[model samples]
Target chain A: MNIELRLFARYREATGVDHERICSAAETISELREVLLARGDHWLVLADERLCCARNQTLCSLDSALCDGDEVALFPPMTGG
Target chain B: MATYITNEAIAAGQRLDALAPSHAAGAVVSFTGYVRDHNLGEAVSTLYLEHYPGMTERALAALEIDAYARWPLLAVDIIHRVGELTLGDVIVFVAVASAHRQAAFEAASYLMDQLKTHIPLWKRECHTASTTPVWLIPH
Candidate 1:
């Protein structure tokens, strides 16, 4: 399946890209993150427990299942007041 | 209920006046968050805010709905500014109106607490003496 990966804050700065389209066979959000982590050191930030995930723009857990064209966002915990 | 996410400056007085007037409303409470000059023991030069557009709006709307559900509120208004902001700039403004002071105060505090943890907004602080900016983790 293909995923629309959206990165923000530290994730965007580390990756040097805001969004990207990627093809992966990962079944869940966590699995997709694991796949990304395999890329290199820069992807290691995804391993942080503080990282937040959203499936299709709605907040979801890492265990959430993904579809063919899911929009997945990875960001740090919100700091807005 | 009203929410706004913009890059423009927030006019605190105008936003307070914009709240819908109600015959039952006897009290109004408001909170304004500003960009301070220092954080984490460092002198800050500027603060950059980022957010998920669609998700941010949805989150804010849901907050207003939750506030209304928890209190007998006559009106609620929230405005959050994005982009680069300098010291002393208003970053956010929230106002709640109710029939009593206690309800208005509690609801306003609830909205701010929920917003700090639940919203999809992020802040990056640029230090005065450092070339790199740091992303602040929320408590």
Candidate 2:
């Protein structure tokens, strides 16, 4: 299975792209982060922790099961007032 | 509280519209935050606002829930704008209606405090004079 991943803010700068994909069927946000970091060492700093994930616009947990067409976004904490 | 969420975000949040009678509550309180042209000793050209799509909405909903729990509120409307924003734009708006002035005032205060500390959003300061904009993260 493949999942669409989105990066925001500093994460986007380090990786040089806004989105990515992982060829896996895991049901955890942690797994997705690993793939991002594995693609390049740039994302390694955030690999240890679960960056924020949105499974189809809804907040997802490490255990949040995803399907084939779900949209997953990874971003730093929000800062708007 | 009434404006639609357009992709375009005002550097500051939107102003609360003239709310008509939604309820018979006697009080209405509002607070609007803006970007000050200067922060500390630096001149701020503009400030950018960003927020977690999921976490931001969740945090905001949670704040609303808390406000209802502690006060006898009749109505509440909280709307926050995202994306790149400039100075003097409305960043947040909190309005409350209650039977009396006390509840409306208290709930309004509580809502602002919660949004500042609880919401998963950050503000970036763009000092045109600086090399790069500073990302303001929560502590």
List ranges where model 1 is wrong by over 4 Å. none
Q: Candidate 1 chain A, which ten residues in sequence have the lowest lDDT sum?
A: A9-18
Clashes of each: 0, 15
Best by DockQ: 1
What ranges in model 2 sit over 4 Å off? A48-50, B1-17, B20-23, B38-42, B51-71, B113-122
Candidate 2 chain A: worst 10 consecutive residues by lDDT? A44-53
TM-score of chain A of each: 0.96, 0.79
lDDT string for model 1 (B5-61, tens) is 999999998888777586778999999999999897899999999999899999898
Q: What TM-score against the true fold does each predicted structure earn?
A: 0.96, 0.74
Point to the candidate with the largest lDDT.
1
